[model samples]
Target chain A: MRNSFLTVVIFAVLVSATYFYLKSPEIVQTKLEVLKENYSKPRDKKPVDHSKFEVLQKQFNSPQEVVKTCMSCHNEVHKELLDSPHFRWQRPVYENGRGVTYLGKANAINNFCIGVQGSEVSCNKCHASFGEEEAMLAIDANAENIDCLVCHDNSATYLKGNNMNGFPDKSVDLAVVAKSVGTPTRDNCGVCHFFGGGGNNVKHGDLEKAQFHTTNEIDVHMADNGGNLICIDCHTTENHNIKGRLFTVESSNTNRVSCTDCHTELPHESTVLNEHTVKVACQTCHIPTYAKVNSVNTNWDWSKAGKLDANGKPFETEDSLGDHVYKSIKGTFEYARNKKPDYIWFNGTAEHYLLGDKISEKETLLVLNKMNGNYNDEFSQIIPVNIHYAKQPFDPGTRMLIQPKLAALAKGEGAYWQDFDWLKAAEKGMEASGLPFSGKVDWFNTVSYWPINHMVSPKENSLQCVDCHNSENSRLAGLNDFYMPARDKYELVDTLGNLMILLTIAGLFAHGSLRYYFAKKQK
Target chain B: MKEVLIYKGYERFWHWTQAVLIIFLAVTGFEVHGGYSFFGYENAVVYHRYAAIGLVVLIFFTAFWHFITGEWKQYKPTPQFVKEQIEYYLLGIFKNAPHPTKKTVLSKLNPLQKLAYFGLMVVIIPLLVITGIIYLFYRMPSATNMNPLNLTNLEPIAILHTIGAYLLVMFVIVHLYLITTGHTILSNLKAMITGYEEIEEDDDHHKKEEKKV
Candidate 1:
């Protein structure tokens, strides 16, 4: 009977194994082949030939002339560009169905340069619309103001002047640039966005010029040897409205671009990992460390600015990473390389303190941009972010952070950079912003958070279980919202469990021995 | 005393293979849990998975062999002499008292041995195998996206698997000590190796019948 049962069981197992071994692979292979076939085909659209456009043949002396020529063919280009936040430098925010305030680089208060109110000339170097006259142009004006070459130019010669009020340098050949205009490449967009906070790899720790051609290990998606995806691939745009946000003031508008738009909510094969996506952002694991190529400015002490050597010449010192740790003109800086991001619960929306907002005097640390979410919020995800700290000027009386006219030093105005005079610079900046400034100027520590959106490591390089589940020195140790298994333990439950296990073993041993002893005594 | 065939060749092969696989699985599994890093995390996980699969295959084969050879009956629990067998190990053996149950080729395991082996095979081993297999393929593509089993966390499964492992470890420790309770220290060990054990000439009927066979 047992032999027959064994034979039947073995036969059943063999049959099932054979079925799966032969059938499952064929099914999976067919599906994989279909997917591969779909992906391998190139995009249907043909590349535009810029050489054929006769309007770009003429020599242009000014950036305005180049814009005028571009508008000749693409007549409605200015209308589209005018509506874009890149051109306007402001986005309208609605509060309770009413337009409250405009937020962007035009009005946003940041730890890095504070505000663009007084530093329009230096800050607007990255502004899309060209010429100083364009800054004053009416919102609905039909004029040659938009700089087409800033994004579309392929000549690589279009260099924007530092103080030229959004105009390119005269040394650039405008005709060559105008003729070579094509689709925006990584280099074109990176020229301004990559070098955001004064210099290359200064502001956002994740973004840098090196991302244009990085190794797969550094960024699996953007790297040339990896996915080789363009910015537009994920940030799919519609009618010139790019689907992304800078680390500026909060806007009422929702972002169209997200990782889930391409990858889906449950991208991971593991069910446990897929579940983590609900409360953990994709970048938290994918981007293990930021600033892979260069060290990022972690802190800036504006109070230490305007320091000079014995010869009266401005001095600068380099950090261990060859980055400027201190410069007499700007401030003392702290740089960090391959930094692990500070994780926080973030929803899509954020709240930012605008310029001239009255802050608490007792509050030493002021948040420039506050992510709107908490542990209880269903929409919140644990996102990795880079926090840039700074000590900047503030009004002692009103306790409001004062934006200093640091850029006005170049124009010989009442700037902090001119004579290291904080009160004069603060007064001028407050006047430009049309806000009342107290005579007494003080410094306050502030933090500005920039969400890490780049430098994605390969899947294999992602953090393991114990990375966050450890009791000590864990990345998620600071996060007390959720109970992590290995990292958290209930004292009573642990003690009881240990006691039970100990008692069970002891009881079993004692029972066996005592029964034997009694039986031996009776014998 | 006379030599009699006890463990068969296939039985011995199954025993040794299962022993080695279990030990390998335990070492690698514990390392993967961050207990201690020997082969590093990645390598430990890989080896643990392989050993688990190997054990699963061995289990099926051994189960089939045991049923086919009519050796499954050896592990059938008999209440008779169970107390005596327990007393022999705990106190009787120490006092030089005689064993209550005699060892035979057909019924080699004592009543206490039957109970322990039954618990291990029916409860603990199955628990370990089921949980281990679940963990191994939990990340497989087919198991993901609309997870039917709702295996959203590894914590619960991991805890269960660890408990099963501890039980098996305890069983192994007791088993190692029990082998020393034979007539001679090396007697049981020699029986498992050479497939023969010495038994007292109790029945003349079996002695003449064995020689004739």
Candidate 2:
């Protein structure tokens, strides 16, 4: 019987060993085949030289003149641009399968500079449309108003000043800009996006000027030494319609660009890891921390605006990280760097609080964006986001949030920045937006969430298992809908388990000592 | 005085190997649970998984050996001597009274040991093995295929595995102390090491007489 048992054991061990050993060769062969397929793909050819174009040789006077010349050749481009969210500044919102309202920068109030209703001149600095007057121009009639050089200019000289009617500063050489027109580079996009909310590295935490020529440590995909990819690589655009969505006031029907477009769902080598793709977003793991290069504004208290130094001049203060913590024209700000993101289950859909949305007096309103999803939703994935908090103005009597005409002071209007007068600015803003506002003014807390989608770290720097799994102060600590091992515990089960262990140990000692006493007595 | 060979070489090897694997698994497993961080969380998880695999392999080999050697009968439980064994441990041992049952090469386990070992081997060990395997491959099949188990919810399996771990810990503590209950303090420990045990001549004579009757 013993010999038979030994034989069976040896046979089982040999079979298992043989099976694994045989399986290794096939796995290695498949891996090599996959690697070959990945590397053998054709490389991209160089872009067409704009210098060869005959029409670009002529000298242009104004930025508008440069656009007219480009339109003469690229006729259909203007029509496509006119239909885009960049040109319209507003997109139709559909709720419950019915078009409800057009939400965008034009009318939607944000926690930042409020809205563009009474401040089109200053706010239109980032607007894709040409001229401050173009904001009032009919969307279909402004086909000629699309500023082509804003995105297409390869010349580093093109510069747009605040309230310059979307044209470059007077000193900019339009002739040089027209001649150097090409596909948008990171520099062109970052000119406006990186300096959004009044200064550099202020709005979006992940975007900054440093990203244009950054190392792999800053942004793996956009790194000059690494991927060296341009904005068009991921934000693939066709017919002037950019394939991306910003979590702003705008309601866009356009599809948001996702990492999965290039990297498939099962991008990871481990099958176990690939399974996490179901509930965990690719960005959640890839971009472990946002604002890697610079500190980003996390909070803005508008009530603290209008502070003056001893010289009676508007004072500005810096935070510990050298980011602007207080700008008298703006507010008291809080900045954070290498900021851990707040996680949420997002279903790729967001709802915005429009200009006139009635807010509750008890709870702080999510004024900018709210991710729409729950744990039960199969479409949802755990995504990292940045929540920017603000204390902004609202009409207490009207029971509605008000948009303060923040930039109206630049135009010598009765704006909040001019006289530190909330009522006058709120009235002017409401009038420009065509909404009624009560004379009474009050302050309310608000929050805006921006999804962290950039500054992807290398896989080696990705979050470890215990980072989110084992601690009460974990990233997903507030997410109570699902049970996570180590992070959560059942009280009854833990109590019983500990009790059983204690009892067993006590019983063992008791039995041993009793046996020892009896043996000693017998001896 | 008489000496009897009880444990075979393979049996002793299997027992010691299994003991080492279980101890390693428990220590690393507790660290993985954030009970105490000794190996660090990442290393603890890796070591725990490897030890669990080692234990599973040992269990397979030991089970095969037991069945083929007919040593599986050692754990076959009987209620006949169970009450007396309980009484002997509780009262008779303190009074220096005789044991409830005689130990033979074929029937080496006491009634209490047979019951406890039966439960541990058949229920608790299998429970831990199944749950651990489920957790190790929880994220299998990738995202391409619809996972049949839908292990998106891992709480239930984790709870079961932890419970099994607790039971195993309790059993080890009791087994460790029970080793000191032999004729001399180190008798059982020495017997396990050398595969031979000393039996009283008077007990051996009484067992022969009773067998003849």
lDDT of 1: 0.74
Candidate 2: residue A195 Cα off by (Å): 1.7
- Weakest lDDT window of 10 consecutive positions for candidate 1 chain B: B139-148
**How far off is residue A100 in model 1, in Å?**
9.7
Residue A289 in candidate 1, Cα distance off native in Å: 4.6
Residue-level lDDT of model 2, residues A191-283, one tens digit each, is 888887777767788888789799888888888766767787789888877778776653443478887777755676554355578778888
Tell me candidate 1's fraction of native contacts, as a decimal between 0 and 1: 0.00
On a 0 to 100 scale, what is the lDDT of residue A202 in model 2? 71
lDDT of candidate 1 over B1-213, digit per residue (tens): 789988876676667778888888878876665445677665676567666776777788879788987888888776777787877776777566777666778667877999999999999999999988777655311222433454445556767776787678668766776686677767998998888899776587655533432
**lDDT, residue B142, model 1:** 24
The native-contact fractions of the candidates, in order shown, are 0.00, 0.38
Cα lDDT tens digits for candidate 1, A1-523? 3643564476457646744553332212223334335434554243766767877677777788888887777787677788777787777765322257776766678877787766666766888866554553447744677777888887888888877777787788887888788777678888987897887889988888898788899887778777666676676677787887654455443774677765666565444566567667888888889998898888999888878899877788996678998888688899888899998877666667787778875687998887766655656778898989999888889788898887752635877666567788888889888899879987889998888988889888988766775566678877786555446544454455446656656755675576557657778
Q: Compare the candidates by TM-score and give the number of the best one.
A: 2
